[model samples]
Target: MSRYREIKYRTVTSFQRRIGNPILKRLPNQTLLETTGRKSGLPRKTPVGGRRIGNAFWLVSEYGEKSQYVRNIQAHPQVRVRIKGRWHAGTAHPMPQDDARARLKTLPRLNSAAVRAVGTNLLTVRVDLTN
Candidate 1:
């Protein structure tokens, strides 16, 4: 990674971890991605912005594999997603090969803009909801 991208990554992640995520996760209607912690074996729920189509939910990870939730998905694909106050069981697939920018266009506009603005290594994640 270039020095600029690394700096941006650290800065953005720090803010999100310390401030953004905690607040967002508490909202009743916030969409959440729940992944079992790879090390602690505990459920870790993260607020995310995504859209559900048919039997799948699609989201973009701004930090790609560097995101903790993404890392957890790598360790265990079995997961749950809370969408609009309801939870659904699913399997997560991180798609590094997908066109994340294009995928973002298909998601919520505000979130897609935010992700595109701050994301360094954008990655697409698709959850196949079994519900």
Candidate 2:
């Protein structure tokens, strides 16, 4: 990765982790992706922006595998997602072959735009909802 891109990733993600996530996670309207902590064995909920299509939910991780939630998914593919204040069980899949930039076009606008603007290593993820 370019030095500039690495620096930009750190700067933006730090702010999002410290400020944006804390506030957004509390909003009932905000969609959430819940993953089991890889080591802690606890639930980790992250405010996310994505679209539920049929029985699946799609999203792009701005940081790719580096994102904590992505890492968690790697440890345990079983996950839960909260959309419209209700929760559903799902299996998470990382689709490296998918065009994340193009996939973002099919998701919610504001968050997708932010992800495009700030993302350095975009990666697509699909969660097949079962509940």
Candidate 3:
């Protein structure tokens, strides 16, 4: 990971530890997802924007496929989510190629200039949650 990203992750982790919540409070239509480590079984949480499509909740990965969180979700789909302060335990379902591409079209592009400045790929991943 880039120094900037490492620092950001540390800062966020500190914030979550001290405040018991993420700094990015209201994510408009987003939700808070808490996943357990597949091995350690420790809880890890992050805020993600999502849309309700029919009965399922769709979440786009703004960080990319290589993210540790993404890998964790892939290892174990069972997850706990907080939407508007209400928490629910569910399973994560990675969107299929076609569905991911379709959902990616709806997401905003990464700020190339900012990414260049930070030296990291600002790609996001797309996932679905089923309760």
- Against the true structure, what is each candidate's TM-score? 0.97, 0.97, 0.58
Please give the lDDT score for candidate 3: 0.58
CA lDDT, candidate 3, residue 2: 73
RMSD, every candidate, angstroms: 0.7, 0.7, 5.5
lDDT score of model 2? 0.96
Model 2 residue 120 CA deviation in Å: 0.5
Model 3 agreement with the true structure over 2-62: per-residue lDDT tens digits: 7778787566546545673445545543467777887888988776656555545566553
Error of 3 at 51 (Å): 1.2
Query: Model 3 RMSD to the real structure?
Result: 5.5
Worst 10 residues of 3 by lDDT: 111-120
lDDT digits (tens) for residues 25-101 of candidate 1: 99999999999999999999998999999999999999999999999999999999999999999999998889999
